[model samples]
Target: MKGLRKTITTAAIGVLAVNSLVMGGFVSGAEIVPGSLQVKEFRYLDKELDRISLEKTGEPDGTRDGHLSLLIDAGEGTEIKSIVLKTADRGGTDTGHGIWTTWKEPSDIGKYLLAVEHDGKTLNKTFKETLGSFKGVNQFDLYASDNNSMKDGEYYYLEITTSAGVIKSDVTPFADADTSYAPVLIREFSWTDLTQDKIGSAAFGEDGSTDGHFKLKLAFAQKTKVLSVILRPTDEDGKAVSAGIWRTNRAGVGWLLGLVQGNKIINTEFNKDVTAPVGNFRGSVTLDLYATNNGSIKNGQHYVIEVETQFGTVISQPVEFGNKESIHTDSTVFPFKTISLKLNAKEAAVDEKQVKLDVAPFSFEGRTMVPLRFVSEAFGAKVDWDKKASKVTIAKDGSKIELVINRKQAVVNGAAVQLDAPAITRNNVTLVPVRFVSESLQMKVFFDEGEIFITDAKEQ
Candidate 1:
């Protein structure tokens, strides 16, 4: 009454579309759409005025001029609390009033202001709908603490005026079959597609049959009551599995009598609808499972699917059918694998000191050679070249070595020595074999797996 402002508009869309919302700010875990009200359990109040269809009259533009009114009796300790505009049926989105609603509760003595949030700015626009006490959103916390709480068995009524505008659906109005009955729906929590989180292996068993189970990441938008999770096994081409093939249910026994949905590690059943103090819209729970489809599945059939529901499904694209391991992240796309190489302090020091060769090592005349200046300097050696003589000299620890390009011999410490591989230039790199000089300079070099490891054995 005080702050209530009416809205005038004309547009509406309709669908059983799937949607989800995240919960927050609740006494339990996360605040969900208030639901604990039983819509499906209405028993008609055994009277002519119990429950009635919402008469929706509209214009040519799908606009409608109608009103939804509810008469009820608040039992002992009960109150006419907050109201939620539902956007969908319990199954999925089918247009309901999904918006900011303002209303006043009527009493025999006087009418009192109760709730009003619908302005142009503050509408809960996620289009999420819930039907119950999802994440511990208390009933009392919804409305302002005032005349909102009604006395037990006292009757009160409220009304909403729908302007001539596009309209979809509203809450089904009902009179009291049971004056004490109340049930509310939390909003749509999530609509998950586990195609990417699909992971498992199918491989040849001792009997030459395939053995493995598929795993999926099942996350709900709300803590939902899971009714069914059906996986249909098919081939790479999505054809039915051939006969004579079977999969076991974990013990490699029982011929996998059935498909079970549960977190085996925690030994908790995932198929069962979760009650209070249990579910939330936080992280995920793994749904690991194996199915036989009444022993009709075969080894050739590897892929399976989660039957579609109000909450979507688990699915993926076809791949080369084989006995292999597969795992997906989210979205059921390709699995991105990550690798890490751990380098400790000592190894890190070597890495920091190792010269980054301008190019990879190459072989000439059966001897591996490296860039002279860079490789030599990496090991604390000084290298210089004489352009007039086409000669390269290396000096380290007072030992001097000299070599001429294309020559097969070298002078080390003023002593001439035979060279199996001569110094040469290829691709602008003056390459040389440091085997003889390095060993002589108290250094050890080893090559493996296409990499060179050098260790200085000299004492500083």
Candidate 2:
């Protein structure tokens, strides 16, 4: 009760916590670990009624059909006995005698809001058995009936009886006066192929007979509305590939093709809204990706699943179809070159091969300066000096850079770009800022512990 307190407020939801009870329950050498128990309030609308009929409100009268959902993630070797919910007021009472023994069928549980699916099956577990049965994160819905509903402004707390002892949640209102339930999408996992053997991997066959499947495990907040889910082919950098790669002349290879729930496969047409179960939020769906004519996915192609929801877009990590060797030949593909330089060191390493520098790198005006010729040539750029103009030009991959001595401005491909420090002559060697030159050449630069690393590929 006397610990850290945190509060989270969103457009349609607000949660107040005490004693480190926001994401997890308060710890006093208890069985449950810290930051594992999450409780949220959601609008529990009647399944038979129109969703638009309910107005968002926080008044006591407005909470007639609201519910509280507790997401419990017990630590290893933990066992939960029962969970009790009661108002903070001293005279508050538990209409069900503070213990939930009766098991509500999955169908009955879906009547209220905050339903969820697990492994493509409707969540069917009693409050006492949710954590133990799931063996991981589990959601338990508390109905807003006369026996369990909380008043609008009343602060309520949960008493979870575990194998160790009784752990209590912080005292907080069930729902904020102004908060409503907003939909949220949390991606659990994504895999390619039918056996789910290739997680986040895709493969294509020559005849489309071995076409791959992209599957996703997505968890949503209560009342979340999805707009569209797209499986788009992309490059190694996760950028979408050229259009028409998704336009297929083959049948059954259409976009938004398959929805897998349990053992049932629901075939849906393209551009149609893929509705998640009414009250369930945690669900898994399978999408088919086949190679067809112009839309055929090439070898080494990467892809990402974009879930456009009412809230916003949720994109998964990039999944590659085949090995990079099958796409880019050794002659055409070049491995990223990493150039390492240390402060005041006369030696530098390009891909771990030492190269002698005419002048050691040093800091000037808080910027790391290196020999312009050596650094430019290290990245395969041509450097030329114009003695009359006191300027140096570096050309690489169609980009031209011109820098003048004692001038803070540099011209990059006909555009004037500002430099932090002007090129200076040190020990008869032209020194320039390493960051500006490397980044301008489309390379990434990182500095740490008196060392600088430059690479053509983005650093992880």
Candidate 3:
């Protein structure tokens, strides 16, 4: 038997029990990986080389003198350490009952051959051979691991030559093989160290934008690929809202993922963002995420971040939006953290040189509604009014936001945004919610003492 035990030892039997747990603790070894075991095709010639079976093996006629061979393939990630050939052993000295290796022809019926063809060359290998019985099941250990194990994507098979007895030795193949007896699979994954770093959002002009945008950083030791992102924004009372969460595309032409709903995302396509998580990293990804000031994304609400990777879904701690939300950090984070994005900046102190609006903004239903021209012009934004169309357009820094008179909706860069309040005319001034200029123009605005302080790249 070439040092191969005729029966499974206690340790080998132990695996059988543990594998049973995955498939209800009642299936076979094949259940270890669930149908990962199967026989492909086999062929054999009778004693006189007159009869052949180039298909699935059926019951032999117990005739003597023959040669047979089988071809086997394992599923991915499957490690075939050993295999058991099962056959019924009819009682009462079955006359033709016996088997041997086909080493030198029509005499041997037990010796198996293993080979791997690569680059037009074939390499022959050895296998531990054994005949065994387990749990009242007649099983032949046709092949077992020595230094040579049945790895996935390798060629392995058994060849049998009968001495009149080979016909009696019933050989069971994978097609009819029981999975409950199959071996376990070893799954492999591309290891990566991915983590979320500082998470902060500013509702003020702190980052040069008052419309309310948040910044988050993700760190990894190597270049990583982002599969998907899920955002869940809730108000003070914890109600779901749609927060427009997006990231700049590689082409820089536009943004990807225009919107996210109650943390649900329908866009599944993703790009590979190569990041260095181990060095003195200063480049951080800044997403302009904010509450649209609508009922769903009102300021002072809490939210969470959920992302999917190859391993599984990764979740972030609950974070509040608006104002400056505290971020989470790790000791492993790079010491030199800097603002790499030109769109983000630290808020400047209340300077004497301030771009104050001519008409002080007033509160409408708890919202600080300001005149579109004063707010836009104060921040270097060109304001255009179409008296014929009754539309007000505010263009600044590659962005164009338009609002219709007495309308509660505005179009930002061709994307429509619904508002909680409408633009109204007061004393010949087209007063609209501060959000139009803040969120739409991404210009941070702070209301203090009835004066609207406008800040942007110039001020920052």
Candidate 4:
């Protein structure tokens, strides 16, 4: 019974109700009325196995012992004459067909006449009573030895031929009993120079120069195929830029290109129909981001890469492309600086300059908590405090961080992010988690022997 329950639950998850009418059929002298029959729920019951795998493997070795549980809803005032369940291969050839009658004789009103056929052989059976006999809801538990036993890669669907019209359910594939599901994982992602030499090649055309190239590495936990790879620009706070501001190209209305692996280009036309099975893939993708128009990628913008696979879609962390020096006319680069603080110490160092803190840093709940105003000011950011609301806001460059006292949620530029620990107020000084605040402001935090170091430089 436990195995039967698990099979019912697993099959219920893959049920999709998409009912449509069969077109191009007209009666000679009668006006056609649309049928109101719908397949409410469909479940594949395998008495031998406890679970069914939705992954598409090759055809099964042989047929399995299985049945089907179908729940149908016939609309009011519309009577269903007969119900047909059929199985077909991937190429639309009928493998099995079954027909059940609802209205026949006085004794057949409650008893259903079921007949199934497979390979020119017919099996007839009489079902006692249908479940849920009230209010047009009917449940059918169908069983057939050879006609119902389906192989992997075969599709099954239900069609209700009512007095009005014919209503067909969406075709669903039979599950493979051998394959288990596993999601794809993004192993590594970064900007690289793998495709730098081939910038102006015939593959890229003449207008496809980019400031940098993105290297994406993926690992397939199971057998899967790549669908698409997209690169989208984001803000400093990692929110995607609006679609109106997306960078376009002369190649197409949107930025679309083939991926490069070593020296070869795969998926040349962005066609997903002709993809092979992937194990571990590493490739480089370049986007043309320079134009004199308004929708081009900005100078100091950040971008993220999204890879869609057969298992699922995975997104990478945001990485910056250009800096402030490229955006502004002034070519002056901001000097990278490091700030060091010690636990329970009133003194700190900012690039050899000593500063005094009113409240010393301490450990709260295994997290390093530091004075909010002192640390934010040291990093050349402006801090504003609201006494009545007990809220603190830190702003630097284009990033804005808002934190409320005693709250575990913080907002970065308009997006809400969870904090490792809530901000606390001690002796009228606000203390926050150093790592969360530093990372939110686009800085890196490191811990040594007894001290904490914060830096604005790229990690080596």
Candidate 5:
């Protein structure tokens, strides 16, 4: 049984209950570092290899043998140090009923318990050596009745530790033996000239109209191979206008999805029924088509999704395939922090040479990038700068900020700001006010004590 057991000793469990009662406990653990738990080791039980790949879909089959071994990283900062494996007693003689080896004990000699001490906490799971009562174990029942409810080949949970709390993901696995889907590439057909030359021949009454064209690129990860593709287009009402499956050329040129490879006109179901996501490009709209790749894609490969319309071809900005591991990272790097208010600078003043402001959380180059102005104004400071003289000033309730340009030197409320390009003015706008905006807003400005320090603080 692949399951979970909160490895806290009986005493530790009491402490958590007490803490919750006293603190009005609202705990979370998944927000620690990303990808904290890794699959350290896994093995297929050779004796029961057939059962490991059994298809329990549709109808239940008790003839399958289910047993496996997995070792995970279990140590400090890790939420679970062990897993409990519980199996039912099949042979009325009580031979098959026992615990699988856990982290606390080795499985080499038929010991039970998948995870154990040597870490901050432990979790336990069970595996069925042979199909028996059909009642398997799961994370919820790992400690109760010494069992869990789970089918063979199911993934249980991911545990992580955080300052505020711990988190877990209830994951499950599937077998490919039951059903398999062949991957297909989706591409829109249309024509385009990279040179931007005007085609004299017109297909419509509008300008830039040409004969049938196709967008060669398909929407899938770069690592995904185009085994086969189905091309379909629908009107605004989702009535299919054309549909065909094309085989891609080894070297991607135009698509070969119509009839024969550069030979015949492919048969199409123009009247087929379908639905598509709609997007507007100026006055015209296009249908958003989806295509499933024929194979599993690498987690982070960038791919291009292109569409061809009667007007012209519009390509989607490149996107990366989703990865289970990066979900938390993406949220953290793009979470909503503060709203940014872009304001035109008012004026320049004495000792008030720089200003700071807060910005809504934004991302650049996979990092959280904030606006300087929003960060500053949030601190109750009036920011102003001189584009010609390259001077910036911040006055909050008479607190002054004086800063120079292209140098790690400035005075904020009499304190110095060691920043490069102090309150830079660009396009008639100032960027990055004096670092003192951090202290002014009661924020913590952190860095290597080098050229510049990024700061964070709550708005007033």
Candidate 6:
């Protein structure tokens, strides 16, 4: 028994001596022992854990302490092939450990090692987290009922957190709609109220009927108060029609305020302060319209007009209005058989030089206004000029085209073609349609008055 004990003691001493020598060599930067192991990697075993409630009730009722996910990595020269999980608590009280973990297949997450020093000896554990190919959501949207419940606003929010970071989106709140009303009848003309005092008709309309254009003759009582006109056609429900108000001069000069909603018109209160002098001024006002509760304008249809006070809630009665033909022609006197004009050219010497052409009549303005057909034909387009409204339409291959003269712009097939010069009415003849100037040079044009309009359509 003594011999056996002695032999065991000697073997243990030899092993200890060798281990100590290796440790010393490594610490002193000398060569390492043969066949010594080295660590090579580190990583977290799980990329992400399921969302969990942090509120703890001491029972597994879908709530618990914040769970910790483990990170593992390998040290230099050694890969941690496996790991085991264990928990410790300094106090004896029972505390929650994370979900039970076991050795499993390494995941797509890169391999890494966890290291700890115990009595100057390094121990390593490997960690890897699972990863999967991401597939985008089929439908992802955030919506809000109201941003502000009391003030008619829109409000909503979305929140999300990922390994990359946390994210949030918000929408503000708003109020509800108010009551609405409409003027079913309107009329305006030079009038003296019960006082028989001369006053511009800021608000007037014939009562009890919705027919015939009620001419509005405005006589400004105050130059500071501009007249605002509104026109709407509505169903018995008081829903408004898509209608527009226009101001014109005795010379037929006019301005269009495109299809405007009556409610919004009242809400915005536009044109209530335009200055006009008190005088016997006669001008035509036309109101284009859409059906009540409808957003579309009826081509070549009747409309209603309503004029309102400059600084009051009073609305005019509805006025019946009509649409005159936008174009007319008088072939009785051939104004032009031959016409000639200059094109828009930057440099006369460049390839972009303007093309000048002459056609037959030579009768317009005695100076020979350019023929609409001749100019459009030069640019490979068929021309159609409306003599009544002074509108010119050009087309190529069955699709309508555009023409712009000086200050006039025309639409061909739903596209606006603007001009640099005003279309002239000379010698009882409409000189030129604007579309000729715009479409000829392959340039874009836009109209800016009270509103802006744009168009770009070319055949395939």
Q: Which regions in candidate 2 have their CA more than 4 angstroms from the true location?
A: 1-334, 458-460
Clashes of 5: 62
lDDT of 6 by residue, 297-343 (tens): 23333333333221111233322222333211111221111111332
Q: What does candidate 3's lDDT look like per residue over 1-460, in tens digits?
A: 0000101101111111111112111112221223343333232211111011111112111111122223222323233333322222222122222222212233445423322211111112223232211111011112221121111112222322121111112222212111111010111101111121112131111223223234444543222233333455645443445554432211111123222224532232223331101111112332333322223333455755433221122334445554343343333332111111011122221222323334455666545566677656655789988989889888877878788887867777787765546787776778876544554655333222233333332110
Best model number under lDDT: 4
What does the lDDT come to for candidate 4?
0.47
What's the TM-score of every candidate structure?
0.24, 0.31, 0.24, 0.30, 0.20, 0.16
Residue 430 of model 2: what lDDT? 96
Alpha carbon deviation, residue 40, candidate 6 (Å): 62
Candidate 1 on 214-233: residue-level lDDT in tens? 55555432222231233434
The local lDDT score (0 to 100) that residue 425 gets in candidate 3 is 75
lDDT against the true structure, per candidate, is: 0.31, 0.45, 0.32, 0.47, 0.28, 0.24
What are the RMSD figures for all models against the true structure?
30.9, 22.7, 33.0, 23.3, 21.3, 35.4
lDDT value, residue 66 of candidate 1: 24
* lDDT of each residue in 139-210, candidate 2, tens digit only: 344433222344444545566656666666554444422211112332332434432221111222233233
Which pairs of residues have clashing backbones in candidate 4? none
For candidate 4, write residues 1-460 as lDDT tens digits. Answer: 0111111111111211112122111211112245565555554443332111111111111122344545555555455555555665544446654333422455433222433221111222233222221224333443323334355555656565566677665454554322211133445555443233333322344444443455555544322344445566677655667542211111113344346666665533323322222223423222322121223444455766555443224455566654422121112132456677888998887765788888999987556799988878888999999888889999998888889999977788787765546899888899997766676666645443356666664311
Largest TM-score belongs to which candidate?
2
Q: Assess the local accuracy of residue 91 in candidate 5 as a C-alpha lDDT between 0 and 100.
A: 18
lDDT of 2 at 64: 23
Instruction: Provide the lDDT at 234 for model 4.
Output: 74
**Model 2 poorest ten-residue lDDT run:** 1-10
